[model samples]
Structures are given as structure tokens and as C-alpha cells.
Target: MPHDHQNDEPLSSSGHPFRADDDTKLSYWQVMEIAVRELLIEKGHISASQVHEQINRMDARSPANGATIVARAWTDPQFKAALLTNAGQTSRDMGFDIGPMQLIVVENTNSVHNVVVCTLCSCYPRNLLGLPPDWYKSRAYRSRTVVEPRKVLSEFGVEIAPDVQVRVHDSTADMRYLVLPAKPAEANGVSETLLANWVTRDSMIGVGLPRAPV
Candidate 1:
């Protein structure tokens, strides 16, 4: 039988008495996940070391992986063809794992610009491009990008010409996307290593363009 604690005060993690009305803002599922994980750890059902190792693996991934691939594509037309044809295999060939999901690489051309968004949730190419940024997972960005892509791009300081068309791609659980930003004219003679510096996470997401070499 449970004791009645209607009149008893609740304490936070810090042992400070807290009001029940305090807003932690965590969802029911999120709170439950934390509770379950803690309980499992306490019971020795799962090792904390295993959890930390997985976390470290995730943290190891970064935007530089995607930048290298983009730079290679810019320099090697044959590699570009292979990447466009099969991004997952191409990524594997380059020592990156894109998981089981299919990766679709969209090329930005003179006539068109492409942007990617996941309206439901942030289904990004995390294995290749690291974690998604905060704004990429926001509701405003997910909703507005599809509706008014040009306006969204403008907010990111990307101004497309009036004649160019803006195409927005919705990523899903089964498929992910990466934008192949057009190589800057000035980057023609740039070395692959140096060109990789021009590719940014936002540019790969299609929110912004790559920085021009100074």
C-alpha cells in the first residue's frame, strides 16, 4: 500500500523543497526514459560504461566528414557521379557509415537551389554530417522552410536570384538528404583540403551557401 503524501513537500534533485507546480518542461516520455535508464543502471541490468562508449562514438562524428565528401565531389567528376548515384556506398567507400537509411544527394545548379527539412522530426544524415543544429530541429524551421523556402534561406543570409527556383526536400526515416552546394567560381583552382574549408554544415543542409575563399 502507498502512503498518502498529499500534504508532504516534494524535493528536487538538489534536495531543495520544490513546488509541485514548478515547470520542468520535460515531456512525459522524456521523464519516463530518464527514470527507466536510471532504474536499469541501478539494477545492473545495463552497464553505464556501455552507454558512455556509445555516446562517445556519436560525439566523434562531425561536419568535417561531410565537408570532405563535398570537397571530393567538387574536384572529381567521376566521384561526384558515384556519390549522386549511391551516396551510402560512396560514403562507405570513403570510410563513413550512413546507416541503413538511403542518402540522396541533391545538386544545387544555376537554375535551382535545394533545401532539406524534416517536417515530422529531425531525420538528418547524422552519421556523415554529425548532429543536427538546434534551429534545424525547431518547429518554425521545419514548418516554414517547406512553405516559404526562399524566405527561410534569406533569413540565413542566403539570397537566391529571382530567376533561380527554390526546391525543398522533406527527409524521412527511410531516406535522408545532403545538399551538394555548387563550387564557387573562385574555388576552381583550390586544393581539395582547402576547398573542404568552404563547405559548412548549414550549406550541406541547404539553409546557407558555402563561404567564399578570402
Candidate 2:
């Protein structure tokens, strides 16, 4: 029924006449609304306007958002430290949202720059990317990832410099994580878009670093 939206009347299915049961005690206005909708259905009242809308409402920057961030850090040490020190706010600064996961950034240090392990489980930052890949959650990866991240990275073909420190992080409870994968020395003056392509979910986890050239 044509909603006299002006009066704020509840619309019936398109344009059905209002119907009211004889014995029902609903107020006249309420009964009319029910009747109108019933009539609309009984007779094809005007076609219900399909309220077209989009469902892919989430704004995911990219899986490479991690890479882009790390790349940004490599080029700018202070920004890198900010990212390493505060993953949540810096992520928001880079046009990504990691606040809900209660992000915490752990930096690599002289003796132990960090690498992460959901040693007990696979808790990852889904808002920035999507679901954790199966391997990240698997016992094989989780159990072995912490014990020997460098070895795993090597098999995946990632060879961390022996001289550089490698700290390990275990994500659990309130915190979720993304890696501040150390920037490549050669990635000088790289654009965020181009740099992101090099970033991969695995690289962020220290199983790999963004690919160097190709």
C-alpha cells in the first residue's frame, strides 16, 4: 500500500488495502496497517521496490598492507620504530584499522629483534587482512614456527642475515599481530602501492620477508 509516509503510516506490501479482523482488538490504525499489507500480498500491490544495496561493506586495504607498512618503516626509521612500538595506532595512520584486535608491535632488537608465534594458537589480525591462512593455524606451522622460525623461513626460501637479531612473539588472548618485516636495504624510495605487492602474509609472520626484486 502506498505509505502515506508523510503521516508515518507503516507501509503495506507496496499498495495493498488495509485489513482488520472483526474480533481482533488491535487499534484501528494498527489493524489498517496489517490489512494493507495482507491485501498487498493477496493482490500483487505495486511491486515492492527492491532496496538495492551493496554487501561488501568492509574496507580492507590489502594483505600487502603489512608490507607497505614495513616498507614505509625501512625508508623511514622513526616511522618504523613507531610501527614497531605501537602497531595499532601506526596501522590506523597508514589507513588501516587494527585497533579492534588491540594491536601490539614488538620490535627486533640487537640480541632479539622479534618474530611472532601463536605458540598456543593462531591468532592473527583479521581486520587488516582476512582469515589466517590454514598453514598459520596448523600444528605443523605453529609448533615448529616458534622453535625455528629461521629454518622455516629458509625452507620457504627466506634467509635472515645471521648477524641480525630475531625475537619471537607469541600472540594470544587480547592481542593480535602483524609483522614489521624488516625492510629490504634496496627498497629505497619505493611507493606504498608498489611496496605492498612485495609484502605477503607469510613474510609478515617471519616465514618470509617481502620478495626482494621480482
Candidate 3:
């Protein structure tokens, strides 16, 4: 029932591909953003250099930043506590510009797993995880994840034990979430950089597990 194709496009018509933020055809909102930015620049309210720097900063953000945080949490209890208590501030303390977005971190324990979804739209913590995968924005994923989480996660190759609970968190424009994956047993005493390598984007999204140490 969660996934209904009632609103699907006609099979006779091929749908347009997903458009990138910088695609040739701009959305109304995208055009507005550009216009507002340029107006601010022309009015001396902001500088082009500052705009470029901000764009570069956003472009530089990736899952790597989140991996670093998870790795540190695995190695340092105090930081992990801080991260769980106040993710937005902790991320800022780690030098990530999360802007005005409110971030909430959920922990994956032996008895429970946390998954993220945006039933209404594709709201995500892009500041920490960069661009979302194309599949994440699909109607099926958005609708079915909340209804049949176990089946959905299994499709991603994640097997959750029957005894374990699956909790789905819905993201919104003002609030976002990140999953703090459980640390691997073999990761003890591993360097943060090496541990970071085990953290994948899907793991942070709760669709996959951390890679085993190799």
C-alpha cells in the first residue's frame, strides 16, 4: 500500500531523466537562487569571491567528512558522546559548515537499526553526505521504505535479524538525520583514516554495513 503507482507517468511516454543541479534547463527555484545571489553581489551585499568560496565549500563536502566523524566516534568516546548529544555543533566543531541545517544522529546497536527516508520529498543531509544517489529519490523508495523497511533493506544486501528492530526516520527541510553505524570488531586500534575507509555512504544512510577491514 505504501508504494502506489497511481501517480506514475504513462508507460507510453518516456519520463525525463533526473536533472543535476547545474543541468542546462534550470528549475524555477534554481533560477531564483541564481538571481538572488547575483542581486546580492551587484548590491555589494556579498562578494563574488565569497559566493565562489561558499560554492566550493559545498562542493567539497562528501561522505568522507561523515566518515571522519564516525571514525573518530569509534575511537573516542567523548567525541562520540558529544556527537550524539549535539550533532550540529559537533560537526561544526569538526570544521564542517552545516549552515542552518539541524542534524540529528541515530545510533545503530545490536538490537536496533535506524534508516532514513523522506516520504514527502528528497530532503537529506547533503552538507555531510554530498549529493544523494538517484535511487534515493525514487517514488518506490520514498513510499515503501516506511511500510516494508526489512524488505527494502534486504534489497540493499543488509540482513537484519528478526530480533532486531528497524526504525525509520523521516527527514524534513529543517531537520536531517545520519546513522552512526556500529564499529567493526576488527577495527580496534585501527587508525582513523583506515577506519574511515570502511565507512560507506550507504552505511551512513542505513542501507548497508561498514566494510570489513582488509
lDDT of the candidates, in the order given: 0.89, 0.68, 0.90
Which digits, one per residue and each the tens of the lDDT, describe model 1 over residues 91-175?
Answer: 8998886677589899999998999999999989987887899999999999999898888898999999999998999985688
Better of 2 and 3 by TM-score: 3
**Of models 1 and 2, which has the larger TM-score?**
1
- Candidate 3's residue-wise lDDT over 1-214, tens digit each? 4333466444323444333456478889999999999999999999999989988888888999899999999999999999999999999999988888799999999999999999999988998888899999999999999999999999999999999999999885678999999998877788988999999999999999999746
Ranking by TM-score: 1, 3, 2
lDDT-better candidate, 1 vs 2: 1
Residue 151 displacement in candidate 1 (angstroms):
1.0
Please give the clash total of every predicted structure, in order.
0, 13, 0
Q: Write the per-residue lDDT of candidate 2 for residues 1-214, one digit (tens) a residue.
A: 3444455445467654456559857899998976876777568754333211111323443476666776677667789778778778888987875546678765444444456678787788776766677877889878887788788767878666788766677886778766666556576667766777667777676666666556
Global lDDT for candidate 1? 0.89
* Residue 32, model 2: Cα distance from true site in angstroms: 38
How much does candidate 2 score in TM-score?
A: 0.62
RMSD of each: 9.2, 17.1, 7.6
Count of backbone collisions in candidate 2:
13
